[model samples]
Target chain A: MSGRNATIEVGATSSALVALIRSEWGKAWSVRAPAACLAGAVLLAAGTAFTLANDQVRAMQTGEIPVGTLVPVAEILASSVMFAQMVVVLAALQLVTPEYASGQIATTFLSHPRRWVVVLTKAAVAGVLGGLTGLLTGPLCVAATELALGDAPRATVPAAEAAVMTAGVFACAAMVAVALGFLTRSGVAALSVAFVLLVLTLAAPAATGKVFPGVAGSALVSGTGDPYARWAALLVLLAWVVASVGAAVVSVERRDA
Target chain B: MRIDDRARRPAFRTFVGTGRQSGPVIVVPMLQFAEISKRYGPVTALDHVSFRVEEGTVTGLLGPNGAGKSTLMRLLVGLDRPTSGSATVAGHRYRDLRWPLRVIGTHLGGRPVHRRRSARAHLRSVALTHGLARARVDEVLELTGLADVAHRAAGGFSLGMGQRLGLAGALLGDPAALVLDEPVNGLDTDGVRWIRELLRLLADQGRTVLISSHLMSEVQLVADRVVVLGGGRLLADTTVAELAGRARDEVVLRTAEHGADDRLRALLPDAAIRPVDDQCDDGAWRVTGASEREVGLAARGADLTVLHLARETADLEAGYLTLVGDRGQQVDSVEAR
Candidate 1:
């Protein structure tokens, strides 16, 4: 049939990039997986923090434990960041895998043929969502802990710093998950790897009295390790994000869609 | 075969709201495949195929299953790169096009829609990536007759509806070039007619439309030119009428005389005559080289009463079958030898 009179104009590459990012954001939330993961993360964090605070309060009141040894709300909230990180990993993994599994990547590449743009836009969307989820969950965990402990001595850290660090670590973990998603292009495989890594990182410090340099969980939660150790942890995590995502970008660019 | 520049500009550019240019227009083939070859490890899909699709024409890519139609289309769309040579659209590779959808719209076979997303939502999401306005989404939905079910999840669509959705997505950009692979698949009679008219209209507007289909009759009806492929090799690139004309036509004659077949064979020594028993009083003969009038006159000269004398013109299906079937036999004979 005769096409309509209106002709579409090609936008600038920057505008196209922005539009791709927006489309990625919409796609991220279009499914129920990301929302369910965020909710699960919040629930797990609050539940764990409240349980720990309640136990400490009961022990101190019954003279079974000393009040001075009670963990503070800030540390409980910081530790709860791990729960949020787990959810972020799952959400980020879901973001890219479903597209690949459904063969929607073909359509995406058709619209924006630049492979790097697709990779980075997806990563950026997942990272921002993960960070925002962390920022919200951190305070909720602290409130749950404080409410449970009542007037007990609450350990505290600067709220602003805690939020920023929590967001940053979660964002980093999300970027790693995005990279893993691209590398595996399978939801089950990426999620399994993320789970194994998170569990191993959580157990490493207790078993060896120190976590691996690549594991940022220990440094991120307590924020109290030696300056060199913390810097090393941050560097390692950053390196993982960069290297994995870089590899993913190259793979996507070179492979047929 | 080279196309002149004057014939490559959109004939109905004024019909669309695109502004007229004051300077000389630079003409280029809407789609060009130059010595393109594709291989998957040890298996080759396309073998150094070359063709050009000019503006304002419908070119049918006619081939059988496994004849590399899909591979050629994928190469043009940049989903799969050619192993050698090049495929370009408006003088630029598909991947390098600044506005891909705006320049060329493509719809490959099968339903590529996300199952969970609504049709409108899916189109809107795709439109966003190209910075297209939401109005364009509505227009395509309306054009594809999908407006009624725009909000329903695509998972529930029938096969025909899915095809319509795919066509809708292709037209979303209102591109100057359209590439469709089996667009008529799963369509009902009316749907097929509708698509045929739509394609003809698009070509009339000076747009380049290339469609791949194995249905020779359908292609004959809609395509101005047909590019035939057999066993991943280019067989014939010519107009439908030309291809049909290349095939040999025959004249069938029946006479009451018992020795009429031998008499006709002797009269037209150059003609290939074959006898046929139609279970009638008179026997029938198929004459290839002579016209119906000549056969009738010869029958009268022999004092034979001719019962039937008519010409059977070769059709597109006959031509395609002859071409492909002959090629198959040649390959078999070579292998045997």
Candidate 2:
């Protein structure tokens, strides 16, 4: 209410999307749920890694399995991703669901009239934060597991592929959550949909898992069986991301906030 | 074509009106709603409603519950697309503007903030969108008297705090126009007074402000112009004085002489005069279309000794209720949709 002049300086071309992403970035970190998810993922990752590697080492000592059994470091991290995946999904859902539930989305649409930009920027923020969660937790989990191994031969491509593959899958899952958040526009409903999809993907056999909703990001880490290879798996994941983001854009633009 | 950075900064350059009133200059409206119609399936929320709020005025969007007041404000901010026509800020459709918040600030009902985000964080998030300076957050926080609880999470805020936070968000861009719906919903007396003065000051600064509220008394005190909607139709759009003038000025008088009623009626044949009767009072008369002084003068001219004469005080609430009698009921059905 101060009589100060309304002196705001803005440039048109690069302002909307760039400023949105920048604003969304600060928003992602400032909220509690996302930061809490990241912290919980890191804690659970380290715990899972240490326990899995220790169990393997103890099995060798007891001759329950052969000694020098190469600890599956990548497998341990992948399993950790599965455990933390739901948390990541919920966090991503928080990106937009809370807004809809509280009716804050109207203000957001009011802020940026072009609905697509807001939808895209939210998905991007979720994807980046989800990817960051993977990048931080994956290598650290591998490090924890390897530290427990103590010269035990590390097995498979997991040593080299753990961080990037986990990041790809986590990032895609987060994007999917963001898209579903817009599609459902309710926290409970979006989380339920995301949960059911995750369960279907996880419960499927390896042969059919590659075709499921989230298997591509996982298939990116390990390998898809027979007919569909890693590259095709990537395309599948990209297709889901594209379709989700597309639906989100349509929901926000074609329908009321 | 490249435009100078500073010239394009406010995001919308005010579109001057070629429309001339009586003077050399024409008053350009900052907010315009032209034939805006919105329907959710069969229910028409707003039906071809059109009105414009001129710059430097606090226009009240007044209506009863579900009177399409909020619906119109929603359409104005592009929260919901109209089935036909357009609502514009600064002479451009809301969606077409590149930096909308820099041109018009809106608060539908607070930002619906995340429970965990602090007030400062919430303001900063909005400020960052327009690349507004960080100090703008503190300035608005202080302006809304939220500087004390700026760092607290919004989850624990009371209704008044939440409203103040919403106002803080709306002011982040220092936009040229503000559209607020039910801005005083939960505010205490002090908060209500603060916002009233705030709206007054903002309008005084040549900023266009449109506030939607069902409280006729509040709108009467704060708004210069009112655009009243009833049952999804435009009912009244005029200045506060003009709207109040819509009511009939009544002069009630009792004469000392019992036969003066007949003489006064004969003296003023055109005025709507009726005797207030309970079968006993024959001298008391209610005169319409004339002030108390006029009524007394006419009685004197007729040699009717007047014992009592008083005019009923006119108020906006009475005028507003009379304007939309029994028609505002349709708003409830449409809102149910």
Candidate 3:
């Protein structure tokens, strides 16, 4: 070893939670996983918008489309939101699984011994990044749709509502994904379970006419369901987020690092 | 607090004499494990094991491959909870410390790092958790000789380099105590010697250093005290010299006069005297329980011309083997229960 001075001073002034949050943020972006997943989501959104816009433009050129057949910006934004939510879920699952797999969680515990603090800090970081991903991709999807349907009377949801709803959905999904990741501590297992949950929640509406809160709430955000259904869906999705995240926190605190 | 001048001096004198200080000493140990027992389902990994590592000393945790050395270290660092009892550093549980790295630094066995992160990024990330200055990362990188490759991905590093990165992470906080498990596993000869010197320097600075290794000779060379474990149970906890002295010591002697062995035997009836070899014509006797001085005096009293006389001192390896080997058999019988 070199004889260079290795003395380091520990700063104990800051709150442990804030330090943990900063560390978690660094950990989330330390690798290419988050960037790759977010980039993939944006690309998927752009491609979907380009394909739909091209189809509409071709129909107008051929003079075969009916007048006022507008593809609303909300519709395009909704599609991109769905895609981004998928990526967020995958990204959130990835955040904790690799640590557990490589046994880096032990080091994590060494840094911040309270398991709950680490879990909550990671969830907060992933949720914020997920929200940012939605914020960036929602407008990109709208711009793509606007470019495709040039000169058509644009129909769209209010900008503020679109931003809030889209980001809220992505953040909630990301939190749920983080919870599943902590519960399983295995990427494959967590991903498998998340996929199953998504399918079951998505199919619940079709099979039972929007009885499931997640489905009803998603439809409300897309502006397809009644106002009462929207309220009920919001409550249901919030409950799911709360339950999933709570269980994850408890599991992590009780289990060994 | 700034590092004092006394803390910077090399602890050569400390190493040469007894591992403790000469003046009035503080009684508090830097690290303590009290009745700590860990059980994983049907297997007991640690059984009521307890030991204190004093400040200004290097304690070696020695055990075989399947022993509970790793489990004990993990317990000390709060990586695992004991099924019963407690482990504390500086009179506080590891989990309760606001800044644990400052109090204790540890490098556990197996890979405990994200392979994809760069060496610098990894250290910085850990540093940020404790609110340490970013410059501390550079300091540790230089200390560990990884400054040139600080930005290199840890996944591509050799096993020895990976170990160095791990040590860098441990030393990042300038902890008062260090708990390292098998630190010399992938190191070369120079790397091994470097660790020994560094640990000695840290101990001399009044830092508590505990290293776990299965290599008896390595521990003998560096450790002031050796804590041996076998089958999840502590076998020996004492100074290196005392451990070696625990083993039987024999005095080997050769005489030019014929029947001198009989005369020596007659002189010390309580001593166990045996022939070194029946086939060899040289009359050499291995005598246990008699000092070399006693044997020489007896031979001189008998007017026997002594050709050679030497006392064979037991080494750490032999003493460790004797301790662990005996305990292994007992542990096996207990496991059958």
Candidate 4:
């Protein structure tokens, strides 16, 4: 025990969250489970791109490929979002629960004192990491979708607008999953809730549109069955993210650590 | 608020020869508990227990198993909230401190460091949290004598090593006060001695030290003040000397001679005499409230040659056993329900 002065300098806000993000990302990279999941998701997206690229080559030889195939190829990257979200949520759960089970929550609460800050820091890191993965994987899938659907009639919209919209869905889904993780704290519980909500709000709606032929059924999903729903779905996803993350913050603060 | 000079050490003369000490003298307690209470459902864990830890002393929270020792520690550092009470560490609730890790360091028993992370990582996280320079992490690692295995994962470390790592993490901030629960549980003899010295050194620097341990001998050797708890209630709170002074007095005698035991027994028939060995080569006798002089005189009259006769004052181990362990049989029943 050294006789040192006790100096408590608090309220370094942005820097604190940034520090936690870097630390969590570092740990995620080092852990084999998440790293493997990430690799699998990326490989799946790349494989789809390669297949679509082959289709583009064949269509070029026959001069029969259509521009509409580009949209589907871009949607391939968005397909990785669900698997990637599972990986991120599981990683966040591991980060949060170990503190409780191992009794490091005392250490953590002692450090931050404000429990909400600690919970929010974890949520923020998960969101940013998930969002970044979206930005990276989105463009590749778009190019692949474009190559597969070569010479197809372009919609009134530019190709870049569709690709960007597709990327936003991946980011939104990842954000929502991460927030759900903070809300649930248990890996299995968070995964279950995310699956139910994603299936009901996103997958089920699209499946419903396929069965019914009119506006009533189309309300469940955006028109054209594009990988990116219009901004409405993104807004609903953002609302879920906010609600889940806010609930986590409130519970962590009010309940005993 | 800074402590006033008068509060630092109350005028010793005023306390001298004073029969009645009144309430709320402006003294600054290193740690103050105000009507602290906690309950787990229908069971009361701690019932309105209050005590103070003064600087430069080892305040031992002595209790039998499940006497709320860990609960009190958890409350002190914000791991658990009191049902209806407050504790102030250095004039602030530990949780209210801006950087609590730097203000009040604690080592809760059974709360080990991350098994996968190296000891250095464990300490570095805390040090980083407090914004301490990286060197402080190494400083604590070296101070805890863990430098040799600093890079090794704590999972592979022995229980003693885990304990040391926990301590190293707690000490990363060089806190003003230290709270440890059963800190000596897994320590070797040398490790125990090292902690004894370390605690003494910290207390001497005017840092408040509250150590909770069931081992009376360990507490006796380390604590200047002892607070005994039984059934989650404060049983005895006093200095070590005061506790010893209040203990039951007994006289012990050992002798080996022809009919010495029977003669001594017949003279003082109330004495409890138990054979020390199978061969009766050594016989021991114990009598409460009897003086050694009386025994010697009785022996002289009885013509019994005495090999050894001594008056034994009850040590803290005996004192603790009498206060807490005498009622220890009820612990299982209490925890079972």
Candidate 5:
């Protein structure tokens, strides 16, 4: 009998982790919604930055504000990261929820029975794509704001720090979204929690609420003079990502697919 | 003890430590359920079920609704774990296999593709994990007759096309064993015949094929042996020939005269006699518990003129109903030859 026989060899040509990474990458880009969301994230960030700078410049021209008011171009660009971050959240949330909705999660489990490996790789992929979106958007928004504020008096030219902050925050936010996706396995449930954290309870002014993603993101993006607050905000965002992704991985290992 | 066995243990039992558990090596069956049981809080889905599917043959896991057929197949693929016993493929759990898709192809139903994702994209995603080549994906698409519509979104596909896509995914790795659940659920007649022939060819090429369905007629044409399940319990392990034979054993006879029924019963006193249809006084009658030979010989021994003599061939649905004791079950069609 040829129970193990085949017309062609079927062994793996790559390591398990590499195959998992490649698979997750394919899954992330295969759907039109995630790609659309990522594009929206970039456009929103750049467009918002352009509009803000253009409005500030126009207000100065109209004499509504004082002529010598200091303008922070980098801060204006980084501020738009908050709104586009929601699009990144939706895009990252997609990496986990579609499989569950289409019942393809079962196929994922079947293709690779190691649940932890699959979950972790998925989180990593979503994180990278989300980070890349922010990485490009951050610099693009900076450039767009610069274009809008042509010849305006500038307070600081810290585009590098602002871009890096945008990238780091967006990456961490995506990991949290992917984690939420796996934790809930339902779009409505995950999106509802996302809304509560990102929109509803945003900046509750409470110490605990400061740890919420939206609050931390708002505080971080708004910080201009104090470097310490920015560091604190970054730490809180990282903590959220670590905790959310950790719980999701454990749930996958313990629960049935 | 100075053992004289210099040969590498028996072929059936090989000692190895790279698979499932490390305590001892377990003998591998193509597909085996060793007293496996599953429960969902208060309900037992499978009760100490034990069965084995051999190589180069197609085995049908026959059962009605809630008979645990899907659960058993899921257990085999490591989709669901057994509460106590083990369900292994080739002496290893599905999760234990370094490359599972190469060993066992799985196609559980109720799974659909992302609506906006193309068919090629769906298969490619699965193949990417297995490190299978893009050529392999195209090969499967061609093999399943989906190459023409490979670029179409699966959401727009018809029922038959969807099933073909599922099978394409299963065959991506060219696994040795194929485990499918209700593979013919929404298939047309052509789809049904196509799958039947495909399964036969796969088994003929030395692959173990196990399919589950509630409609016995679905498997009547494809399966060689059927492992019947009822209420999550094993009811019968028999050949398709045995199940199909239920449609036989009674002979139909027609006499030249309308009132020859009494003479026929008198001639074959040991046989149970009845009319083919009671509404009409036609000369046709059904004789049970007797072969065509006995009826013919009895009629010849007497002066009875026989117009028509033939053995009865009924549908397997009646036999399945009798075996499962579920008269409310409905079969899609009666295809007995």
Candidate 6:
């Protein structure tokens, strides 16, 4: 028989890819990763409302409308997504790195001899889970914050857009974390590198905005360093995910697992 | 051994749209290594080593600790790429294979299984990966003697239990070929025997099985053909019978007589004679190398007494040691020169 007979059937490859996504999501669902991320989003929303609530009480006492008295649900949801991004990065670092450290990757790679398939499957699962979590948590946080603050801004289309934009950011960052974990194959090293990069990204723009006035200074917002420039951040983060994950997958196949 | 056509099970047809055999002959080589070389920075792991693994035989990749046994196994499964050459399993390189898990099974490190998941779940994941029926999970679990603990979490398993679980996972897809590296390392005596039986059965089923081990004794019992390597080079590639024949350098003999050792030494030049120092050796000499008839003739010629004259047979370990030792000496002398 030609050695080509050894090629795994297409049916098997598709099934394996599906199974990988299901199992990865299953693992995340079973653990504290998703729940913890939701909690962080809830906390951010509550914190944003508490600030609005205090501003309202002070306005009532003084018999005057407080400046920026009502916090927009859009702003609250955006902050919620930023907080979710932090939690997702932590989750990716903690969860994905175990497969490498515990030698599970060996079995995983052995099971799906196609290296790129495995890498892409893992990223897809992580990205999907991050999206789902944001979809669920974003609206819930907005609702809770509205309830907490008596005169809080109601849910708007912008809040939904902000939520999706937030989800995209978190998902991109989480995927990057997974990719880095695979490349470094060391949990602590990958997480440290991830955290350091995040810090640099957050810090460099703020420093640059401070040095330059007007357009540049307006780019630095408090919650995520800058909201207007987030598209650029998203692109940079996506590129990171692709390059790191591509390198990791290729190296895994070309070199030893 | 001839395969009995009558004993062949009916071709399995799971469903109308399920897996179907496309051809009569699966003519691809079981495994092919061509001019494979691996270098780790300043150190070379394997150098231009090449070999083939055919179906229905247990092929042993034998080498000492630094001879690249693990490296070669890694290269074969695409865990590590060859620096120059290529290794193909069945007919395709690992990365090119569409469904790898179902085609070729590999057990690289004997690391523990996923402790959080049950053995059954572990097998299920692998089976699912290959699009194999879920029933195959239980089949392999049972085959590896892991049925009793199939529902138990793999994390708390003993080392032997973990090894069995790993084996079960490897067999999940009913792979056509198996590449196991030190599969018996953590296995107990029973586990070792179980693997030996398992490999033999797989080979008997017309599947290629390549097992790598530095332990000659482990490979000796199972390997039909041995590929002995030293310093990352192929030293001896032959059948067990051939290796045994080549190792038949010493002939054993025993006699009871004072100064018989010296007399036998004098009779046959280059003959090694030593006094038998066992509990039964009461002034008896256990000499070797000379044939039985020659020893008798020597005894008569020396006017010595004969007690025991049985030829000592060389076992696999002895044969392996002899082969490796000879190669090692040649290497040492070459380095010296």
TM-score of chain A of each: 0.86, 0.86, 0.82, 0.66, 0.87, 0.70
Sorted on TM-score, best first, the list reads: 5, 2, 1, 3, 6, 4
C-alpha positional error of residue A18 in candidate 3 after TM-score superposition, expressed in Å: 1.5
The local distance difference test score of each candidate is 0.77, 0.78, 0.76, 0.63, 0.78, 0.65
lDDT of 4 by residue, B1-337 (tens): 1222323522111112234566444545667777888888898888888888875568899877888888888887777789998887765676666656666688886645555667777666666665677888888888889999998876698888878888887787777678998888899999999888887777656566899986777778778998877677777778887776766777777766654667877777766655555465455666665689978877777887788888888888776666655666344322211
TM for candidate 4 is 0.79
RMSD of 1: 5.9
Off by over 4 Å in 2: A1-12, A54-71, A147-160, A205-208, A224-228, B1-28, B252-309, B326-337
TM-score per prediction, in order, is 0.84, 0.84, 0.83, 0.79, 0.85, 0.81
Give per-residue CA lDDT, model 6, range B91-111, as digits (tens): 568766666666677777565
**Model 1 ranges off by over 4 Å:** A1-12, A55-67, A72-75, A204-214, A226-229, B1-26, B250-312, B326-337
Clashing pairs in 3: none
Model 5: per-residue lDDT, tens digit, A34-82? 8899999999999998999999899999998778788777568656887
Tens digits of lDDT, candidate 2, A1-257? 22223433333456677878887888888878888987887788778878888888888889997877767666676676767777888888887988877666766776676788888889989898889888877777888888888887877445446777777778888999999999988889888888767656767777777566656655566553333666886788888889988988887788877
Candidates, DockQ: 0.34, 0.39, 0.40, 0.34, 0.42, 0.33
Judge candidate 4 at residue B286 and give its lDDT.
66
- Candidate with best TM-score: 5
Better of 4 and 5 by TM-score: 5
How would you class the docking of model 6? acceptable
Best by lDDT: 5
Candidate 1 chain B: minimum summed lDDT over ten consecutive residues — where?
B328-337
In candidate 2, the residue pairs with backbone N, CA or C atoms under 3 Å apart (3 or more residues apart, or in different chains) clash, namely: none
CA lDDT, candidate 6, residue A167: 60
Location of the lowest summed lDDT over 10 successive residues in candidate 5 chain B: B1-10
